[model samples]
Target: MLQVLVSRKIAVAESICSFELCSLNGEPLPPFTAGAHIDVQTPAGATRQYSLCNHPEERHRYMIGVLKDPQSRGGSQAMHEQVEQGQTLTISEPRNLFPLAADGKRHLLFAGGIGITPMLAMAYELSQRGVDFELHYSFRTQASAAFLDVLAEAPLARHVRLHDNAAATQLDAATVLAAPTPGTHLYVCGPSGFMNYLLSTAASQGWPAEQTHREFFAAAPIEHDGDQPFEVELASSGQTFHIPADRSVFEVLDEAGIEIETSCEQGICGACITRVLQGTPDHRDQFMTDKEHAVNDRFTPCCSRAKTPRLVLDL
Candidate 1:
């Protein structure tokens, strides 16, 4: 973790704030590529993962755009309420799970609301590389959108297409996704429903899964209507631990002196991914692709539960 000072806090849009974090020391901060995110230790002690919105070439500081969620589970609430411009924050190094497809022939980027954060970085990097790409951004209204000016300026303006719900030219995923090139890639970030619809449309249009990538802001709620207790056996010590239906494997293991590094407890960060030696997992995370989830070789312990009565973890 790095101790960084929040240098600037600017209201970029309605209910959204962009935080500029500079290193405490005079030294340059760690380097991060586009589509990277840092785990921020919120004032409420919750670890929230926020994507770096600034250009990857920048090393002096990191910028993250955060939208205030009305139903915040602790992360966004404390950030808006207690965090100040001069406050020091503990943040993890950059980790990129939503990297760009650098080898692709062409790129199609889609952004919805705050999901535009990472797309901004991708556009910057893609523009720097002088690649062929287009960014389509959708928002309820222009006021609710963040970084309109940033998207308007050079290096990003031409490649972007704005689609606000109030306007007639809203995003038409089916039409935009009509053509499918062999090496054309698609990337999207935004609300779960929007992402799903676009991805599904692309899939129906014969877009290969390998050519598509995404990053979710949050995991959809898992229905535990028929949840049951399960058992987990560690491969290291062969010790067994019982996981209650109401609790997660992360909590149960942490209580037994096992520490699993985790962020975005909602299962969207892919932080607490644990290898599964045996047994099936009721995959509940949006982090892993459907293909990865089908393998059943690993699962996020933060929110995923076991399908079998007992699971053998490679812990």
Candidate 2:
């Protein structure tokens, strides 16, 4: 954990605030890639992940944009209400689950609402590297659009396209993802509905799974009508524990004195992904691809359950 001081906080948009966090000491911070995010321990005692929006080359400080979500689980509300400039915050080292493809000839980035945070950093890096890239940012209205002035002043401003629903300027995923281009990669970060539309459209237009990348701010709420009580067995120790329907596998393991590294308990982050030694898993995570879920060799215990009566985990 790194202790940092919030040096500045500015309202960049209607409900979005951009914070600049600097090291407690005047030292260079840890290096981060374009699409990296840091887990912020909020005042509400919730560990929330926020994307780094500033250019990665600037190592002195890290910048993150936080939206005051109406449907927040206290994390966003805490940042918007309780956090202030000069306040100290504990943050984890930057981690990149959504990284730029090293070998892609061209990159296409799609951002929806607050999802533009990570894409902004990627744009800066791509511009600095003189790579071919374009960004399409969609928001509800011009007033709600974050970083408009900043984006306008960027050197790669011409490569950005903005669509506001209030002006009837909507992004047609069918038209944008009409065909798959060779050596071109697509990265999308957005709400679940918007992401589903883009991904389904891309798949229909012949886009390969490997060429498309995504990061979700939160997992879509899944129905638990089919969920049932199950048992989990440890491979190392011949021990088993009953996982009630109301409790997650992670919770059960933790109750039994088993610890696992976890960041996003919503199953968006792959931090708590564990190897499955035996039994099929009822995969419920948004982190892994369909192919990975089909393999059934690993599972995220944070939200996933067992399809069979018991799951043998390689713990």
Candidate 3:
């Protein structure tokens, strides 16, 4: 973890905000991809992850935008209130789990609220490559969005659609997620409820799970029936941990002094990712797709579990 500081803070909107930050040591940082995110250790030491919106070619400083969530548990509130110029902070190196597939012929990007950050970078990448793509940005109002100028500067201004309405303008999941032509990929980032409905609707419309992609800002509730306890074996140490019926995998690992790189313990961030060497993973995290598991036997330990009694994991 590297210590950084709040170099500058500027209010982008009534509730949306942006910050220009740099390493406290004033050294150049590591490079990251388009959809990369950094785990921010807030002034209060509360760890949170936010996507990097800056261009990949620029590496001197990192830029991040935060939306003032009214329901925030003092994290975003503190960012809006106490995080000022020259305040010290600790941040993790960038980590990117949602990257654009090179083979995608047609790209459909969706953004809701602050979810536009990563999508903007994706649009930039696709534009640089002269790829065919479209972006659908949905928000409560135009004032609530950030970086409107950059979106308009893209190659396909006609392909950009903005819908702002708190009551009207329902996310037409069916229409927006219509059958993808061959080599088409759909990527979405938003709140849990919006993503759940959109994904289910897309699935109903015959969009394969592989063609649909999503990035989660928060973890959705786990859909489970009766309680079940299981054993998780750390492949390296050969030590088994008993996951209690009520406790989550994160709580158990932390209590055992296992240093798992994680930001959102709720499973929104893909930081606590590990390989599922054996057993069936009851994947509860939103960061990965079912198709990804078919090729790579990886899983997020923050929310995923084994369907069998004993599961082996690569720690």
Candidate 4:
């Protein structure tokens, strides 16, 4: 973890707080691509992932916006009420699980509520590349919209379309996604319900899975009542281990002195994604895209188990 100073803290919108972090040593920080996020060590002794909202080209500081969740998951509340400007904080280097398509010809970015954080960085990068892109930001009200000041003067403002539900600015997914142009990719980040409805609309329109991308802040709950024990093989030692129904593959491996770097063990982060040398995975992760999971080449060991009795891992 890197120690950084919280140089600035301000209210970006109703129930939303923005924090600016700077390297403690007064030097350029590690470089990160757009759509990257860092694991923050909150004041309440809990770790949470927040997307880097500032331009990736700016190495001086990293910016993150946090919404005061009524759910009180500990991270958001701590960031808003406990952390203060000038306080020092610890954070992991940025990791990207929702990066832009390298060769995408055109981009359609959608963000809802606090989901706008990563979209800010992505818009900056896309604008710099001179790529054709549009950013649709949806919010309940202008008073509750975050980063309005930034958008008002930001270079990417021209490419932005604000959709305020209070103003009756309806966003018709079917109309927007009607013409499926080849090479035009779509990226969306938002509340699960918002994403589900939009993606469902896109799917109904016959959009290819490869042409869509998304990032989830949390995973939907899954049932484990019918879970069964499974065996996992480590290719390096040809050693096998048993994974119980109650324990995850990660827990089983760790008990045997196997270490797998992980964050968000709930399977929202890709840190624990393990390559599958053999056997199919009972994927329980929300990190990988559906197309990625269908390939069955990698799975998050933290929450994913094997469909087969015996599965092989690259280790």
Worst 10 residues of 2 by lDDT: 150-159
Query: CA lDDT of each candidate?
Result: 0.93, 0.93, 0.79, 0.92
User: Model 1: how far is 175 from its true place, Å?
Assistant: 1.0
Per-residue lDDT, model 3, residue 46, is 74
Instruction: List per-candidate RMSD values in Å.
Output: 1.2, 1.1, 2.8, 1.5
Evaluate residue 180 in candidate 4 and report its C-alpha lDDT on the 0 to 100 scale.
79
Clashing pairs in 2: none
lDDT of 1 by residue, 235-304 (tens): 9999999999999999999999998988888898888899999999999998888899999999999999
Tens digit per residue, CA lDDT, model 2, 1-315: 999999999999999999999999899999999999999999999989999999999989999999999998999999999999989999999999999999999999999999999999999999999999989999988999999997888596888988887887899888988778888999999888888988889999999988999999999887899689999999999799999998999998998889988999989978899999999999999999988899999999999999999999999
Order of models, best TM-score first: 2, 1, 4, 3
For residues 209-258, could you state the per-residue lDDT of candidate 3 as single tens digits? 77778889877667767758999899999999999878777789889998
Q: Distance (Å) between predicted and true CA of 11, model 1?
A: 0.8
- By summed lDDT, the worst window of 10 consecutive residues in model 3 runs over 287-296
Off by over 4 Å in 3: 24-27, 154-159, 166-171, 223-225, 290-298
Per-residue lDDT of 132 in model 2: 94
Instruction: Please identify which of the two predictions, 3 or 4, would achieve the higher lDDT against the true structure.
Output: 4
The stretch of ten residues in a row with the least summed lDDT in candidate 4 is 148-157
Model 4: per-residue lDDT, tens digit, 1-315? 899999999999999999999999999999999899999999888999999999999999999999999996798999999999999999999999899999899999999999999999999999999999999999999988999888877688899989998987867889888877899998889888878877898898888988998888878888998999999999999999999999999999998999998898899878898999999999999888788999999999999988899889999
Each candidate's clash count: 0, 0, 0, 0
- Order the candidate numbers by lDDT, best to worst: 2, 1, 4, 3
